[model samples]
Target: MAKEFTSLGLRLHADAPHISYVFIKHHKPKEGEAEVPNALYVAGLPLGLDEVSLEAVFSVFGHVANVVLHPSKRSAAVVYESKEDVSQALQHASSGQVVDFPLPAPEGPVGLKAWVASHRAQRPGNAELQKQLDGWMEAHEAAEAAREAARQAAMAEDGWTVVVRSKGRKRAREVGGMSTVSGGIAPAAAAAARAAADAKQAKQAENFYRFQQRDRRRSELMDLRHKFEEGRKRLAALKAARHFRPN
Candidate 1:
């Protein structure tokens, strides 16, 4: 459950001389909202007469919600819906005259708002409360500082290094067996080395296959040209023979 700070105050009527503080039994009935259909029972009345006696006393106002009783334990609680009903019940139930049984005092003051204001005046304000809070905060901070100091002292006593490890690339290279004087590999130089190797390999493999393809195509063209020239010579000879013959 979440914790909360609610202020509860007690007020006494200045004129009521007989009572100092009303003794609400350490075990008293809890007052619930009026709509709930349950009432508490007063304990230790004679078994058969108990319910009849309570109903007779409480039903005078409105309705008796419920009643609880334990004769051996000698305690009881009665519940009613209306404040008017409860007021009427209390009128008859208190002292030995009605039920001849003891009952607890009413829970809250007769004038609740005035009682609350009186309590607020008597209590501390936010500034004084804050001062107390600040004192606690300072004490907590001092305790934390002491703990940190003790931790550091323990580390020193055990020969631990307090300095943080450096995250710089140059420092990492020096730690990893590389020289720091030259400031590591230059970007341009690394790019040039990779490019030169790629260019040399590309040039060697490219033209060797292209030269073989070109030579094969040239030989096939020459053979086709020779065959076409021979065909032209045979046609010319045929035309000459036909002209020379009787025509």
Candidate 2:
């Protein structure tokens, strides 16, 4: 087989590895497997063609449903309302057909000057903005003052000593050997006081109801025993006083 292939000038060298050829038949379309209707792939479109202009040109033949333009490829895919509209467009529309149509009006600012004017019209003046910022700062400061006053009143009511920190970044000297006291009690001391109060309250409540129940039970048992003893003595006296006894 290698020599026969070499004689035919097919194989470059004799005694080469056997080569296998596998043939695949062309794919045939099944029944009713036609391309979709009412859509057409249109080529040779003008470079400047936009979706709106393309639609306008195609709409003259029939009602165009949609027009998608590919500017780089200079082509468009147009879908019409019906297959008949696509057929009509293909029959009539050729090069230079439907050349004159009304162009759409410009939707936005056309030039750099118009854009700059629009932008300036939308922005607020510097003086107006500064005044607004000053008003906002004044309001914010007033709100802070009111909050601080309310906080001080609340701290005083709660028996917390208010210790004001030194102003202007000076290190304030500690009073009464306290390491740090900014607004009220130091966080560590406050936490210890709260924990001690909570423990005392829990100790007072622990087993309180159970003690009452035990005391009430003891009192009831004592009363029952005293009643039984008194009844026994009275019955003994009645038995001793009996005049006649049945055998």
Output the number of the lDDT-best candidate. 2
Runs of candidate 1 with Cα error greater than 4 angstroms are 1-110, 113-123, 161-247
In model 2, what lDDT does residue 16 have?
30
The TM-score values for the models, in the order shown, are: 0.25, 0.31
Give me the runs in candidate 2 sitting further than 4 Å from their true place. 1-58, 66-78, 83-94, 98-143, 166-247
Candidate 1 lDDT, tens digit per residue, 115-199?
6867987877999889999999999999998997687667666765444333332332231232222234566776898899999
- What local distance difference test score does each model get? 0.51, 0.60
User: How much does candidate 2 score in TM-score?
Assistant: 0.31
